[model samples]
Target: MANLNLTQNGNFSSLAPIIPAAGDDNGRSTLIFLGTGCSSAVPNAMCLIQPSDPPCAVCSQSLFVPPEKNPNYRCNTSLLIDYCQSDANRSYILIDVGKTFREQVLRWFTLYKIPRVDSIVLTHEHADAVLGLDDIRAVQPFSPSNDIDPTPIYLTEFAMESLAVKFPYLVQKKLKEGQEVRRVAQLEWKIIEGNHEKSFVASGLKFVPLPVIHGEDYICLGFLFGEKCRVAYISDVSRFPASIEYVISKDGVGQVDLLILDTLYKTGSHNVHLCLPQTLEALKRIRPKQALLIGMTHQFDHHKDNEFLAEWSKREGIQVQLAHDGLRVPIDL
Candidate 1:
C-alpha cells in the first residue's frame, strides 16, 4: 500500500505535513494543500447554527484545537506548487486562491517561508476559487519607492468574463490622472483555452489543462502539471468525460505519479462533486502510484476517515488518503 511504502520511504506521503525550513525544500519540488475542503469547507457554519443533539464530530473536533493541530478544520480548496527552475528561480504557482486565501497565508505561508506568488491559475470563476484575488498584493508586495510588476493570472475566457464582472479593477487597473500609485495588486490577465491537448507554461513548469464537467453543464478545469514528477490535480469534478477519463487512465497517458482528486462526501451523490464511490472508481482506473482526496465536507472525521482510507489502500494497492489543510507532500516534478 502507498502508506506503508510512504512511511518506509520519503518519496511521496500524503500524511507528511513536515514544514520545510526557509530555503530548504530538501532539493525537490513540493505540493502543499493550503485548503482541502469543499466550497463550504469543513466545520460548516450551518452545522453549528442548527445544532444537532450530538453535534458534528468533525466540526466539533475542528474547534478542539488550533487549525495546525486539527485536520478536521479545513478551508476552501486551494493548492500551492513550489519548485525551482534549472536557472535557480524559485516559483510559487498557486492554484485557486479562494475565500480563505488570506487566512491560509497567515498560517501556512509563514510556516513554509514562501516569498511570493510567481503566477496564478483559476480553476473557474466560483467564489471559493477567485474571491481572494483582491489580496494578490500581499503575495507580491510593492515598495513605496518602486512600481510593482504585474503578476500573471491564467484563466479561461469564461473565467475572465466572470472576473471582469466580479472585479474589474483586477482585470484592468484604472489609474487616476496625477494620482500617485499606492500599494495595489498589479495583475496581468492571460486568457487561455481549457482544451485537453493545449498546454500552457506558468513560470517555468508546463501545465496541461484537464477540463472536466462540474455539475451538469458547467465546465471546470483541473490540471496535469509537473516539472520532474507527473502530478495530476482535479479539485472540483463531478464526472469525467470519456475523453478526460482516457487522458488520465492507465491506458491513456499511463498512471500518473500522484493524483489529487475531489471527494465531496463519503457516500451518496452530489450534483457537482464526486462521492466516495466515484472517487474509488477513479483511483482504480487512473491507478496512480499515490492519491490524495480533497474538497471534503464536514461529514468526515479526519482521523477516522484516514484510517479507512489506509485500509482501503491496502486492499486496492494504491496509496490514497484524505488530505487536510496544511498537508505538505514532496514531489519530484
Candidate 2:
C-alpha cells in the first residue's frame, strides 16, 4: 500500500520521493522549458496583434505595462524533453504545445541552435496546446541547409481522438492520396499488471501515465519520468488520485523531485484546474523538493505572484518558481 492518503477533496502526498537508480542504460535526459505562460502567454497583448477590426480588451490592458519591464513578453507554457538523438528517438517530447509553440520553437531554435525536431507528446488537445501543429510542419524537413523530413506525434488515445476531430488533416492518414505522411503514435493506457503501473518505454525513458480528472472526464494523464526523478505534470487536471503514489514511489524510494502543475484559479472554485489551496494541499502530500506553477493566465501578475509564492513555498519547505519562456532545467542522469 502507498503511504500517501487522498483527502475527500482528492489530494495525496507523503515523503519526498527519491530519484530511483537508473538502469544500465547510458543515455541522459534533458528538459528544456519552452514556454511557461498560459494559453494567452506573457505580454498577453500579443494575442491581440492578430488582424481584427477591434483589438481585444485584454491585449490592450496588457500593452500598458512598461516596455522596459517586458520587451518581448509572451506566453510560456510548453516544454521539450529530449532524451536521445536519433531519428526514431522522438527527440522532442513536448508537454503542451500552446498557441505560442511557433514562436517558442523559433525562439528555441535561435537560442538552443536546434537542428531538427522529431516528435511531440501532447498533454491535452486544447486550442492553446494543439494550434501549433501547423507551425511544427514549417520546420520539419527541419534542416535549414537541407530538408530533414516530417515528424511524428505521440498522444494519448483521448488526446488523439480530440485532435483528429479538431484537425482531421493533421492525423488523417487515409484522408486523401499523398496525405498519409503525417505520423501519429496512439497511446493506450496499459493496465498495470502485478508490480507494474501502466508504463511505456519511449525514447529510452520510462513514461508512467497516471490518471487525472478533467472535469467529468477522467481522460487526462499526468506523467512520471525516470525511476526516481519523477515529475507529475497535471496542467489541466482538477483532482489527484492516490494511485499517483504508485508512480511517484520509485522502487521503495520516496517522492518526485519536482511537480510542474497548474494553478488556474486564484481563490474561487474550479472544476477544471486546481486552485491555490488545492495545489498546496497536493504539494504537502507529494513533498517534492520543488514545485513550479505553470499555465498561468493574464489575471495573475508574474512578479507579484512569484514573490508571494516564493515566501509561501519557503514556509512550506518547498522551493517555488513561476515558470517562464526559455527556462531550461537539465537533470544529471
Candidate 3:
C-alpha cells in the first residue's frame, strides 16, 4: 500500500498504479468514479458567480484550473465496476451512462486502457442518467468474439420503456427489404422487477435492487452488488426504505463494506435529492465501514468539504469521504 497524500488543489496527489496481489490472485474488482457531479455538473454555466458577490470560490477556481489539477470539476454522476478474471480477461459493469458518458468513457480508456464494457445497469431514466445511451456506438462490437451480440443492459421496465421511446434505433432493430442497414448501438435489454422482492444476475454478478423514492412520483433503484465485494450504490436517493435497511444491514448492524451515497447539496434539502443534513442522518443509521459521498454540486469545494468531513469523522469515529472523478477503490474478490 502507498501513503495517501492530499494535494493543495484538493485532489489526491497521485493515484497508485493498480497491481494484482501476489498469490491467491483468482480475481479482482475495482470501483471507479467516472463522475461525481449532479445533473447540471460542477461549475455549471448558469451558476458561475463572480468574485465580488459572495462568490463560490470552488466554481470560480474551476474556471481557471485544469481538470487534471482539480478532480472535483466533475461531470454527471456515474460509476464503473471493473472486474478481472483469473485468466486476466477484463470486463466492466457501468452504472448510469449520463450526458458526459462519451467523455468519461474516453477518459477511462486513456487513463486505464479499458477496451470494452460488458454490461450497463441503469439507476433510472432521468436525462442525466440515460442520455448517453446513444454514445455506446463508440464502443460497438462490445465483445471481441461476437460483433453482432449487443451489450447487455439491465434496468426497470419503466426505464426500458423510456429508452424505447428515446432511442428507437438502439432499442428496436428492424430491417427492410431494400433498405441498407444502419449501424447503431447494439443493446440487449433485460427488465428487472425493482420491487425489492427478487435479485437478478448479470454476467455472473448478483444484484439486488433496492427501491427508493426520488421525489413525488418517481422511483429510483439503488443496487447492492453481492458476493465477496459488498457495495451499495444509491446515487439519487431521497428516501431510504426499511426493506433496504434490512438487506444491507446484519442484525441491525451495517454489513455493507462500501456505501456510495448521494449528497447533492452542502446544506438545505431538496424534494428529489439528499442534502448534507439528510445524508448525515442516513449515514448514522447505515453505519457502513466506509462511505463515499457523490452526486455533488459546484457549491462543494473539495478541499473545504474534506476538511469538514475530516473533523466530523474524527469526532464520530466513522470513515467517510467525498468522491471525485478518476478516483478508484480496489475490491478483493
Candidate 4:
C-alpha cells in the first residue's frame, strides 16, 4: 500500500527537462530503464512466483510487468545512464554494472549503437552489483585497428578495497610472472573525486554522492545527476536524510525530476533496504515529477504491483513507473 499525495501544480519550469539524443532538438535527456527487477529477477527463487501456475492475470493482454512467478522474470539489479550524443564531451556513464553486465552492454550497444563505455560508476561492492565487471573485457579493443578503447572504472576508495577483498584474483599481483588476464587489463581504476560532501564531475556527468545507511556493517551510495533532473538511485537505503531530501526538494539546487529508488521489501522490514511504505513517504518529501521503483524482488508481481502503484500514484498525483530490462525513458532537457 502506497500513500500517493504528490503535488503536481508546482512550477517545474525552472527545471529543464532532460532531452535524449533522439527525437527533437530541444536537448531532452533520456533515461532507459534497464533491469527493473531486483536482484532475484524472474526465475530466481524469490521471483518465480508461478512455477507451475497459469500466466499472470493483469499482464496477460500486454506483458508490461513480469507475471507472478514467470520464469521469464530477469535479474533485479542493473542500470546504465547515457547522456545523449549532444555535447562533444558527452560520454556514456554506467551505474552499477550488475551480474548481467554482458547482456546489458550488448543490449545497449545494439539499441544505442554504443561501441565504447566511457566510464563505470559503481554504487556498491555487492556481488550482484559488481560481478559483471569481468564482462567489460569484451568492449575493450582486441585489435590495434579498433578505435574505441577500454573505459575507466570508477569507485569510492572504500569500495575499491572491498572489491579487492571480494575478487582477489582480479586484484592479486602476478603470482608467477605470467601475463595478467585480459579481463583484469580492461579495468582502469579511478577514485570518486571530490571533497566528501560537495558534488563533483566524474566521467561526463555531474555526480553528487549521497551516503546512506545500508546495514550494520556497511554504508551505501546514491547518486544525484545533473542540476535539474536529479535521479537518486538509493537501492539499499534504509532511511532518507534531511540533506538528501533538501537536495531533491525545494531547498537545494533544483527539484528532483526523477527518483529511481529501491522498493525491495513491500511488506517486510529490512534493516537495510527501504520498504514500499517508506519509499512512498520519501516521495512526498522529494515530490519528483516522475518516480520509478527499481531493485524489485519476486515477492512483488510486476503487473499487480504496478497497477496498484499507478492507481495509488494517481490518487496522490505522482507519476510512477516500474522499470524493466530494455525499457527506455527519454527525459527532455
Per lDDT, what order, best first? Answer: 1, 3, 4, 2
| TM-score (C-alpha) between model 1 and the true structure | 0.91
Per-residue CA lDDT of candidate 4, range 1-333, in tens?
A: 233221222111212234222343344455555466656454454223433356533234234643322323555466666675447344666777777777666655676666666788887888778888776667766753323454777788988998888777655545457644333435666787422276666565778887777776677788877654556666667876666667666456566767888877668677778878888887876777677788775566655676788787778776665655565555532
Superior by lDDT: candidate 1 or candidate 3: 1
RMSD of each: 3.5, 9.0, 4.1, 6.1
Cα lDDT tens digits for candidate 2, 199-240: 765445666666677686655667767554667666777886
Q: Rate the local accuracy (lDDT) of all candidates.
A: 0.82, 0.59, 0.78, 0.63
Look at candidate 2 and tell me the lDDT of residue 212: 72
Which candidate number maximizes lDDT?
A: 1
Q: Between prediction 2 and prediction 4, which has the larger lDDT?
A: 4
Candidate 4 segments whose C-alpha is farther than 4 A from its true place: 1-28, 46-72, 85-90, 143-150, 172-185, 193-196, 251-254
Candidate 1: global Cα-lDDT?
A: 0.82
lDDT tens per residue, model 1, 44-68? 9977788788887778775567778
Instruction: Identify the runs in model 3 with alpha carbons over 4 angstroms from their true place.
Output: 1-27, 49-55, 86-88, 142-147, 176-180, 250-254
Worst 10 residues of 4 by lDDT: 6-15
